[model samples]
Target chain A: MKRRLPLIVVLVTAIVCMALKFLNLGERGTTLATDLDTIVQTSYLFAFLFGPIHLIRLHYSNVQKRRVNWAYSAFLVGVCAVCTVVFFINRIEGPVSTFIIDSITNATDSAIYAMLGFYVCSAAYRSFKLKNVEATILLIAAVILMLGQAPIGDAIIPNTSKFAQWILDVPNSAGMRGIRIGASIGAFAASIRVILGLERSWTGSGS
Target chain B: MDWKKLQWIDVRILYVIIVVCLLIPMFHPVGLPVAISDNTRLVYNTVESVPDGGVIWVSHDTGPGNAPELNPMIAALARQAFRKNCKIISTSLFNQTFGPVTTFEIIDEVAREMGKEYGVDWVHLGYRDNAWPATIRLMIENIIEGAINRDWKGEPLDQMPLMKQVKSIKDDVDLIFCTTVGSPGYADWMTYVSEPLHIPLTGGASLTMYSGVQPYIRSGQLKGFLGGLRGAAEYEQLVGVAGAGLAGMDAQSLGHMTVILFLVLGNIGYFAAKRAGKNQ
Candidate 1:
């Protein structure tokens, strides 16, 4: 009953959604779609609580167990708790909440992201080698792309930007479109399978 | 000195060299000229073509990781839009934590500088839940109902003068400018809103996603799109304002050059090692 009930709900929702999207029911269809959308928005908002609840539960368990890197988990739990309490007291857009987010959260997030730049530099130097024909082509493309993105690329090699744009517009766009079409078709098939109760992995009962 | 030894240099040394090269531009401005691309110019012209005081829906679907690349696009867009007396209704659906706050800060900064009053000239709808096509679909029908009738600050949208003017994206929005890093972005806007409503969608994406969006650009679903910081820099130039995009170009130029130099050296060492191995 546990699995079958959810599958039944999915089937109904999928059929209704498809009908609302494809069929020309006019004003009535529009109203039905809006009502269904409102229900989705409400469910989405409720689903928001699941993240924090799961986060706290996982980290609290880690802290209690004193597992490896438990100190980081404890710190995360502490920060999450403090932020939640503070947000409740002062509201999300309040001065104190804003300060914490702007100063601490944003700073840490940006700093961590910035570290990628250093790693990328190291990786490009180490991994970008001319071992074979494919590696040589990749290395050359990497050089051209890197130069083309920067202003100095034009100064050094004229029309590098134009060449880069061609690569992106022609070859890259073609590849991307093929992948997107294939992925979309795959996703449609997967969605149908889920709707028809063929895909049960999401229910944690395995497919 | 062995040629093969070039590839064996400690990664920490490469890091230091990169840091120095990147930092040099910060202290000493290069003022390099940025050539505008057709894609960027198309984005600028699309916004320019919006009827005076027409509403633009800005969906800043980005997080902190891509913020530096995309935030400048928003600032540049705001500058151009405000100059032409366009009203902006902004939303951030990428994240509840960073997207709303960062989008608000960037657009609000530009708004304050341009002396545009909030809730009148512009209103930030802020972060909505990731309901994708549904939330955006509802927004096309009714903005207030879609966003639960509240602004980012949890204030009632009815109180905002701009909200009163702009009710539904389908009827009111002249253009949809989305700076996106991933899904629920330009694709969602194009498929559900822009194509259905016939409103033009134009904006920027992180360079990482630039190639993926090119097909849309070719299809004219996106009028034209910006690619990463380079795109931001070009748009900033066209807008006649020097912001972070312009300021960071010198560093970006040096950084790219440094990487290319290392790539060349690494290759030299690799080939030399290969040749020596064959000879031995």
Candidate 2:
């Protein structure tokens, strides 16, 4: 009953949603679909509660076990507590939260992201070897694209930017479309499987 | 020509070289001449065509991580839209309130500089916790109560002068410029909102997300897209406001040059080593 009931609900909901898109059942159908969507959206609002709970639970367990870097767990818990109190009491734009987000969150994230430059250089130095035809082609294309993206590239080679745009507009688009199409087909098949109740992995074991 | 030794240089040395390369450009700007791309001009043209006082929805689907790349574009777009006296309705899909709200705070600075009033010239619809499709669908159907009943600060939408006529996104908005980092973003806007409602959609995406928009641009789903810092720089140049995008490009150029040099050196070392082994 547990599994079957959920499967039945999924099939009905999927059918209704799909039907709603194509069939114009006048004002009543529109209202029904909108109301159904409202319910779904409200349910999504409840999902946000899970994120903070999950974070607290994970860190709480870490602190309890005195795990490696448990001090960081304590710090996480402390920061989370302070932010929650500050937000609830004084809104997110309060001086404390703003400072934390701007200085700590934004600054740290940007720094970490900026480090990608170094990593990419190191990775390219180690990995971009020209031992084969494919490697040579890839190296050439990479160089062209890199040069083409920057203003200096156009200055150096009058039309490299145009060629780069062609590479992006033509070959890149073709490859991306091919991947998107395959993925969409796979997704459609999977959706149908789910709608038909054949995709029982979602229902966990015993189904 | 000890190619083997060159190949085995320590990674830290590469890091130091890149750091120096980036630093030199930052302290001493290159001021490279930026020529606008067709797609960037398309984005500018679309935004420029928004009639004075037309309401346009700016979907802020990015976070602090993408701010360096997307923020300049966002600021430039805001400046352009505000300059045209367009009513701005902004939304963020990131969580309860952090990403979109903070993004608005940045845009608010621009709005203030342009002497545009919040809740009058621009109104933030705030974070709608629903999936992008549902949120966008509700917005199209009954945006007033369904999606944005209150501002992010819990102020009623009815009180906001700019939102007075915005009962439905489909009826009210002139254009959508969605600056997004990843999924549940431009795709959702394209699938659920723009395509169905026939609203012209433009996008601003990180350089990494640039390629993903090509298919949409090709299919006419997106009017155009701004590709990362370069796109932002071009738009800044077009808007006649030299912002971070233009300033950062010098560093970006030097960084790319450094990477290209490394790639050439790496490949040369590999081939030379291979030839040396063959000769031996």
Candidate 3:
């Protein structure tokens, strides 16, 4: 009954949601859908509770075990606790919360993100090679695109910008569209399988 | 062939060089001439074409990491919309706790510059967690219910005069612009709001995600799109204001140059090493 009840609930919810989306029940229908959405949204918020609980449990276990770099885990727990308490006591816009989010959190995140430029430089130096024709074409196209994005590209070769645009609008777009179509079809099939109960991997077992 | 030397350039040296290239340009910018593409112009014109006293919904679907490339576009849009005297309804589907702070910081800066009044001319509906397309769907049905009781400031929505005219997303807004970095973003807006509600939607995306957004723009699902930092710079240029978007272009240019240089040197070493082996 445990597994069967959950599966039934999932099947019914999916079917009802799909039906609600497709049907036009007039103002009453819209009201019902809105109510359903509110319930779903509230449920989502409840689900968000699991995230922090899981985080604390994992980090606490690591700290208890004195795992390698357990000090970092301890730090993570400390930061999480401080932030959560500050947020609860003073709300998200409080001075402490603001400072933590904007200065400490945002600054660190941006700095980490900025390091990508350096990594790209290093990665290109270490890994990019001209082993074959395709590699050469890729290398040239990448350079052209890089140049095309910058004004210096125009200064170097005025028409390289146009060539880059053609590359993106034509070949890149074509390839992307092909991938998107296949992915969309796959998603559609997956959705159908889920609705019909054929895809039960969510049960943590392969079908 | 001394290509062997090229094969083993210390990665730290490359990192130092890239940092120098990026930093030098920032302090003393190259002031490289920026070209405004047709798509960027389309984004500008779409925002500009909103009638005086119109209301527009701006969905911020990105956060701090994307601030460098995506934030400028938000600031630019806010500036343009404010200049046109458009009422702004700002919301986010991410950063449920701190996203409103980011949204307000951008919009408030623009509002101060334009002397626009909050709760009178603009209001932030704040961040809605987990409920995305549903949030959008409900907003189209009833904005007040969807946004809860207050703006991000905790002011009651009933008292906010700016929301008086906005009863539903379908009826109240002139256009929708989503500054997006990933999914539950442009796609969600297109699916839940634009297509069903028949509202015009535009997307501003980071450079990395521009390709995914292109097909939507091409298919007319999105009215237009802002392509990364360059697009933001172009939008700033159109409005005759210079901001971070324009300022960062120089550093971006130098960084790209550094990457290309490394690629070229790397390849040269590869081919030369192959030839030296053949000769031996």
Candidate 4:
């Protein structure tokens, strides 16, 4: 019953969603969709607590066990606790809350993301070698794209921007659309499998 | 000099060189001209074509990681929209913590500079939970209900003059400008909202996503779109504002040049090593 019940719920919800999306139920259908959306949203709000609860549980267990890098876990739990308290006390949009988010959270996030720039430079220098025909083509395309994206590309090679735009408009876009279409069909099949209870890995019991 | 050794130069030296190349342009501006692309022009013209006072739904679906590339886009959009007396209804669906706060700050800053009242000219609905196509679909039906009657700062939507004028996206919105980084972004808006309702969808994406969105542009599903900081810079130029996008172009130009230079050096070393090996 434990496993069957959840699968039943998924099957019903999936069918209802698909029918609502594909059928022409008119005004009634619109209202039903909206209501379903609200229900989903409310459920999501309730599920929101699951993340922090799980985080606290895992980290607190780590702290209690004195596991490797438990200090970082403890620090994370501490920050989450303080941030939660601060947010509740001062509201999410409050000056202090905003400062903590903007100054601490956002700054750290941006700094870490910025490190990607350095790594990308190093990666390109080391890995973008011309070893064979495929490598040569890729290398040429990369150089063209790099030049085309920058203002100096046009300055150095006239019409380089136009060449770059063509590559993006033609081959790149064609490849992306193929991937997108393939992925969409795969997603559709996956959804059907989930609906039919063939994909039960999500139920935590594995398929 | 052993040419093959060039490929093995310490990565730290390369990093320092890139840093210097990026930083030098910041201190000494090269003022490289940015040519506008058809894609960027289409985005600008779409916003321009919206009747004065038309409401634009600016969905800033981004995060702190892509903020530098995307924030300038919101600022530029706000400047252009406000200049023509258009109203803006903003939301950020990307992240609860990152997108909402940064988006509100950028739009609010531009709004203040333009002397546009927040409630009347623009109202940020803030970050909705990640209920995506559904949340967006609800907004198309009724904005007030979709946002739960609260503005970004927890203010009542009914109290806001802009919100009062805007009831539903279907009836009120003129354009959907989304700055997207990933899923629940332009694709969701295009498929679930814009295409069904016939509202024009257009906006920018990170350069990484530029190619992926090109098919939509070709199909006219997206009126046109911007591609990362370069696109933002071009839009800034068109809007006649010198903001972050324009400011960062020189650095970007030099950085790209530096990478290209290293690629050439690395390739030369690669071929030399290959030739040496074959001869031996």
Q: lDDT per prediction?
A: 0.90, 0.84, 0.82, 0.90
Cα lDDT tens digits, model 4, B1-280, are 8999888889898889988988898889988898889888999999999999899999999989898889999999999999999999999998888998888889999999999998999999988888777787788888998888888778999988788788999999999999988987899998888998999999999998888999999989999899989899999999999899988888988999999889888888888899899999
Instruction: Report the lDDT tens digits of candidate 2 across residue range A55-140.
Output: 89999999999999999999999989988888788767788777776788777877887777567778888998876899888888
lDDT of 2 by residue, B142-203 (tens): 77776557877778888777777777888888999888788667988888888988999996
> What is the C-alpha lDDT profile of model 3 across A41-137, one tens digit per residue?
8888888898889999999999999999999999999989988889999887678887888789878877887787677668767777877889778
| lDDT score at residue A79, model 2, on the 0-100 scale | 89
Which ten contiguous residues of candidate 4 chain B have the minimum total lDDT? B131-140
Local accuracy of candidate 1 as per-residue lDDT tens digits, B181-275 = 88878888888899989999999999988889999999888999999999999999999999999998999999898888888888788888888
Displacement of residue B53 (Cα, Å) in model 3 is 1.3
> What tier of docking accuracy does candidate 1 attain?
medium
Tell me how far the alpha carbon of residue B32 in candidate 2 is from the true structure, in angstroms, after superposition.
Answer: 1.1
Worst 10 residues of 3 chain A by lDDT: A1-10
Instruction: Kindly give the stretch of ten consecutive residues in candidate 3 chain B with the minimal lDDT sum.
Output: B92-101
Q: How close is candidate 4 to the true structure, as a TM-score?
A: 0.97
The top-ranked prediction according to DockQ is 4
CAPRI docking class of candidate 4: medium
Per-residue CA lDDT of model 4 for A38-93, tens digit only, reads 88888888889898899999999999999999999999999999999999999987
Model 3 lDDT at residue B245: 94
